[model samples]
Target: MNDAHLHMLVNHFPIVGTILGLIILIGGVYFRSISIKNTAYFLFIIAAVFTVFSMSTGEGAEEIVEDMPTIGHEIIHNHEELAEKFAIVLYLLGVVSVIGLITNIRNHPKATFFSYAIVAIAAVAVFLSTKVGTSGGEIRHTEIRSEAVNQNSNAASPKSENNEY
Candidate 1:
């Protein structure tokens, strides 16, 4: 398969994983369970790894799609920018999760701190993921574009007697 296909395959894990990891981590923290926290950490690490794969394949995907008839360079560029920020947050979350795992395994005093930190970072990642996903969706899904919304609104308006929309 081409890079675009590969990118589509791998790109979703980071967003979904981070969201799941965040929920799981919150549960772990609420219940005060080290084991659950570790599980969340593992998921975060996996998400981070997928982020790497997604970022690596992104350039190739862009090269392939940039010339397509309906795709906009600006849309891709916006998605790329948001994706970069999202990647950074995920990477930080991953590294912090590793440390959290180690500390929790050893019963370190700072394990709680790391848990909270991961929660905060994962929250940011989740927010960015929404923007990145929407922007990426706009690249191909013309029905959801801003201009499309405007056109739809205009079309839905009540017609005047003069037959002018």
Candidate 2:
């Protein structure tokens, strides 16, 4: 599949999986259940995998959408920047979650501590992802799209060849 298609398919996983993981993590903590906590840890791992997929397809996505009429270039720019930030956060959380899972399987003493720590990291990820999602949504949403048009109209310069990659 094309990058844009892959982007559309996988982009939702990080946020949605994080939310689902958070719910399970919270439940595990509240109920003090090992099974539930382990499940949440696995979910975070799955989310990490999706994050990789999203990132891998990003350049393809950018190439496809950066040339669309209106704010396509601007939206692609913002989305690229935000995606970079989001990837860093997701990678960190994913690593922490992996460690937490490994320790849990080994019956390590610090497993619970790492789980909570990963949860905290995941919370920050959730916030950043919301911003990313909002910026991405603006790419095509009428209100933001109109704003983009007006802002660019003021400049009224000849459209330069988009060199974004």
Candidate 3:
């Protein structure tokens, strides 16, 4: 498969993973469960790793799709910018998660602090994920673009028989 195809395959996990990790981490905090919190941390780390893969493939994918019909440098550039921000958040989450996992393992008093910090970071990551995902989708899905949607809506509206032109 080409870079674009590979990118499509691997790009979603980081978004979904951050969301899932946040939920799991919140549950862990609510229940005061170390294991659950660790699980969330693991997920974040995996998500961060996947982010690397996605970023690596993105340039190649751009090379392929940037010139395609309905796809151009501007859309890909927007997606790239958002993706970069999202990647930084995910990477920070991963590092913090590692610290959290270690602290929990050693039963450090600061473990709780890390957990809360992770929750906050994960929340940011989740927010950024939505933007990144939508921008990425817009790279290929013109139907979802605001201008395209507006044009389609206007064009698709029904005309009344007695309506003046």
Q: Which RMSD does model 2 reach against the true structure?
A: 9.4
What would the TM-score be for candidate 3 when compared with the true structure? 0.93
Every model's TM-score: 0.94, 0.83, 0.93
Estimate every model's Cα lDDT from 0 to 1.
0.94, 0.84, 0.97
lDDT of 3 at 44: 100
Model 2's number of clashes is: 0
Question: What ranges in model 3 sit over 4 Å off?
Answer: 156-165
**Which structure among the candidates has the greatest lDDT?**
3
lDDT head-to-head 2 vs 3, winner: 3
The 10 consecutive residues of candidate 3 with the worst lDDT sum are: 156-165
List where candidate 2 sits over 4 angstroms from the true fold. Answer: 144-165
Tell me the deviation in Å of residue 95 in model 2. Answer: 1.3
Clashing pairs in 3: none
Candidate 3 residue 157 Cα shift, in angstroms, is 5.8
The alpha-carbon lDDT assigned to residue 142 of candidate 3 equals: 93
lDDT by residue (tens digit), candidate 3, 1-165: 999999999999999999999999999999999999999999999999999999999999999999999998889999999999999999999999999999999999999999999999999999999999999999888989989988888889976889876
Lowest summed lDDT window (length 10), candidate 2: 139-148
| lDDT of model 3, residue 109 | 97
Backbone clashes in model 2, listed as residue pairs: none
Candidate 2, residue 49: CA error in Å? 0.9
